[model samples]
Target chain A: MSLSRSSAIPRSALTTMAASRRTVLRGMALSGLAVGGANLLAACGGDDDSGPSSGSGATVKFGINEADGSGPAYDRLKGMADAYTKETDTKVSLNAVDHNTFQESINTYLQGTPDDVFTWFAGFRMAQFAENGLITDLSDVWPIDGLNDSFKQASTAPDGKQYFVPVSYYPWAVFYRKSVFEKNGWVAPETNDDFMALMDDMQGKGITPFAFGDKDGWPAMGTFDILNMRLNGFDFHMSLMAGDEAWDGDEVKLVFDTWRTLLPYHQADPLGRTWQEAATAMGKGECGMYLLGTFVVDALGENGEDLDFFTFPQLDSSIPADSLDAPIDGFCVAAAGQNQEAGKEMIKWLGSAQAADAGNNAADAPFIAANSGASTSTYSDLQKKSVEVVSAAANIAQFMDRDTNADFANTVMIPSIQEFLKNPDDIDGITASIQEQANSIF
Target chain B: MTDIEQTRAEAPQQQRAAAPPQGREKKLPTRDRWVVITMVTIPLVLVVLLVWVPAALSFALSFGKWNGFGDLDTIEWVGFQNYKDIATIYPPFWPAIQHNLIWLVFLFLFPTVLGMLLAVVLDREMRGSRFYQTAFYMPVVLSMALIGFIWQLFYSRDQGLINDVFGTQIDWYGDPDINLWAVLVATAWRHTGYIMLIYLAGLKGVDASLREAAAVDGAGEVKTFFNVIFPVMRPINLIVIVIVVIESLRAFDIVWVINKGRNGLEVIGALVAQNVIGEATRYGFGSALAVIMMLISSVFITIYLRNVFREERTR
Candidate 1:
């Protein structure tokens, strides 16, 4: 008749549950932890630790939408929050939520006056927060923290104010199988001919040259973005990114047509398989290569054999070479956060190189630190090389969907790419439809 | 003993003699009147605030241009335009409505037939009959989200259970030809178990003498089932039919999970979800869809309600 947890439990049960969680994590980390189905750590949130802390001191609620990446950073963040709580006599409650539920919690927090500091990504995504006056501008915090002006410019608001601190910047590049390259007697391609010939050679050998996870639709975009850079050069990409109509010009078609020609090789149940599963196929050397953001490092290390990678092989060598999926994930203080001063302190701690060090200690840290001079030896050799591939580039383009409206990007662009890949003959119609969707949105 | 006897006597004194003093009985303070008001006011105010206000707001917003945020004053008054747009003009309207109707048919017909058969079979008190009841309704306990993903796996072209069994690579999700049916299969799977249980109850409620009487009349087994058992199940049939109609019209979770309401299959629930929670924030449009869903559902509700009254009068 009663549905309440108001009854206190003996302390023994708490210890037992915590002990079992540790055992589960250990069981999960061992090789072949699961058959066919891969088991990732679950992320969940929402807890009943509300109201003022009373004599227990002030408490701050925090939410982290946990993506199953390296598990270490989450632990570090929890520890840091704990330390902050201990130092300031404030109770820190860190809520780890699943990515799928992120939108619900975010909308709730935004709608209701939130009693916690939460995470948000940088770039165009922050625009909604900024427009609604929901996010705190960290311009003052940015300068005090001594974060490089270079990184700030990439994600700073048009008003010359910063809304978020770049906790981590991802490095993106194409991953290829070392064993396949070695067996095929092919060195890493330096020229357009070399790249195509290597691909043709792999295709001739019945290896899918480009193993992609278009299940998400964004993965096929990696190949397209690389082609854009190859055909249009870095400056043209910048121009198109600046909302120039030249995006649909002949040079862009050349890029689109490049994707059209690659269809024959990708025809094996390519619709709706995730990027990680795509990498699983590539990692086992079943497929020749997979072009992905370095973030895929989190997915590829099933048995600790990280696939080797190269800068997406250049077409002109004069054109910039970068991966298709480098976006930033950072934290920001909400405009009306209760603990503004404490939040600034948190941002300063997050922006430092040590933060990156703690964040990347796990086996699956996607890329090296964003801070230019920070050391990243803890990362896999392929990942470190991928990071260098991005940093060394004179120019970079924002991933397409990110640089566009999220609605159009996910719904129209992604599905269009998938449909086009299923049959390239759908290009003209799909492109026209995409252009129309963009036109309507913009 | 004297005090106890006096109290016992006083207990019955009202019936015996104190009844004469009732007109002038000792009156509690009029303050108690306020207490009654306070007790009733609390519940009345709460109900009006919680239920009536939201219902009013939903109706009001069905005629607005609100985009799911901020001050209520910011909502634009758009007249019957929202309704006009949704009724026939909107892209996802009619096709989705047609699909929903098809779903209503599927929901009632398939389940009713299957449930009656299963219930009749199980009601025979055959060996392990209890086990069959438990096993039959097992899927009702599973989370629909889990069921959706499981069904998606079954429908998958590669490494899927169904495809593996059939030895044919069918694009269950992508191929628009059979995707809706694929989704319907999962929905039917979860709902059939419950519908079957309801029939099991109806079968139990049937009078034993009637079926025996029909058999004694020289009716064949099928004839006895049709002539005797079928009539007794009409009430349960009406209940199951109404519930299925409502569930099918508001079917959102399975379809939403399968495709997020995309891949060219549009239904009213999915469309409403898209406008409200999907990338689009057309709250007014979503409310318009909700109102329409309510209107469509009320048709089935009205039929069932009228049947209830009619059955009562007959009884």
Candidate 2:
């Protein structure tokens, strides 16, 4: 009656089992390994070591989100690190981790022995860390030249203290090749009617109006963000993201309803395509336009030179088309770093226009530095355009995922949105489910 | 009778001569006793630490809520709330259960049987059997991540080889109805090879005389397989069933890669990962999932061990 290890041994003798018996145990053992493996990962949080480093020379470890081979993103971060090292005469150790891994491990990384200054995104993601005391307050780093009020606001947490240092930003918009637009004699749409007309015109010309993809689940959030911003306005969208606004509200419903109407104009089977693949379709002229971040150029590669973008058209006349999802990427100081003083110093310098310029100058595919004082001489047409749109914007969103609780955004929103994409008709059900889940989490 | 026997006769006296200070029974040499203690203690410690501790922790954590940050004091004991939510509110839970069961049944029905058949066919020393064996076994050696990536080349909707070759446009990985089947097909490709290798090894070990004896008794190949050889390879059959169950229950990597187990590709393991593995630290909810999965696995393990114990009793 007992299920014990001792019971397993005599059965081998009784059964005269084949060698595959061992292999069967190996399979079971593999799962046992998986259980232990997952738990080991769970147990990987770092012990608190908040004491300052006792070393003679000042040094700081920076946990970079860019791995070595990630082209320009890595190059820019490396450039920043080198600049910091040169300015302070202190060594800044760069511990590079892959982007996704860095994000996934952020909770553990922060609780554990995190590097002094780590790369991170702004908005609610940063605010969450600040709330938990995972990151150091950087309010003292304010009044950085070339950084505007909006950039400063993005860095500030709920407690009126800054946790993030603005570095660069990219806005999501409707990207199109200038060559295709010129050839087709198409103009950028400004209002809802004009947008629909453009979509109709593109469809008539035998081109898919939009190159859409949602396989990763987050790409479609950019669409949802713009639609919500246009229809409901920025304040409402921000509140919706903050979980203060109901997801099942009529305003949110309108966004979904409008999206449903526009679905036909988007590329079919979007759940199957990655954003890169969709971007390729746009690049190849199979699709007329793509609504994505400026980084869509990376996917376009050579055709990137011809890339031009316009902000998503306004749906409600009362709500200006001034707000867009311009997710700001930046750096933060780990509260538990051994060298907090050095970390804060480095983060302050990181906020400076000179640091932005150093990073921008060192990389070929330079980011649109948040500091306006950074050199714009190396700016591409797209970069120049992005800066113009962002500056002109009355409100900015850190995209849907960044503007909400990580747990809620990932576990609830990703699937709910994907579910909506699968069955656009179930807007009511989807929104209700979202609200129910949000109620629990928030 | 011999010099060694004479020495053994004097061993107790010799041991007593060396150390008689303490009242003690005769035992093996201290070195050998230490060695035995070390051997027993090490594995016991490992089994307790690696297996039982985590399993127990997972079960305990299922009753609590925590975001997997800060200290243990942060964990709020919410007793059964996570499980309640998972069963009632979580959309992915039931679908994940269904998919896991489907994966088990599908693996058993197709790849396990097909692999055995392939093993039997290749068992007859046919021309290029070695080549066929290598071809079938190639996918088993590849990591599941690589296999998922390779299949994406064929499963891509607009540009995949399947569409280009067949002149059809089915979203293999996107359409909910088709994506599970698509992923299952990829998993079976690898599973088939694994089962084939194991069955082939088992078939190789089958006594040649048993088959010859059946043949002499006027048994055809099919009849011989069923009547005699199959019955004799019962142990191998049990092992195969065990392997299949284990493989299906732990089917996470392929589907996770496909879409993080969403939109009909949901499996219990993937759901756990989706909640706990990434930035989302819904720890209690994920632990409830892990506990439920463990409970399911325990049923199969119990059945397996019971069958083995019953067989042993008969013997």
Question: Which candidate tops lDDT?
Answer: 2
Per-residue C-alpha lDDT of model 1 across residues B236-310, encoded as one tens digit per residue: 878787778767776666666666555545677666655554344555666677667766767778888888999
Pairs of residues clashing in candidate 1: A215-A272
Worst 10 residues of 1 chain A by lDDT: A1-10
Instruction: Spell out the clash pairs found in candidate 2.
Output: A46-A112
**What is the C-alpha RMSD, rounded to one decimal, of candidate 2?**
9.5
Q: B47-138 in candidate 2: lDDT tens per residue?
A: 77556766676677778777765566677899998988899878889999999899999999999999999999999999999999999999
Point out where model 2 deviates above 4 Å.
A1-57, B1-34
Q: Write the per-residue lDDT of candidate 1 for residues A1-442, one digit (tens) a residue.
A: 0000100010111111112232223223211222111222122123343644322365666667664442655654564466555556666667676554455334334444343467666655566666666677778777534456656875577677887777666656767767667887967777678778888888788788877766555667667766777777765764564456543467766777877776666636566466776777787677887777765656765423445776776665565454344676667776655556666666655677665555555334333466654456766676566566666666555677555545545545665666676557756666665565455334
Worst 10 residues of 1 chain B by lDDT: B1-10
Best by TM-score: 2
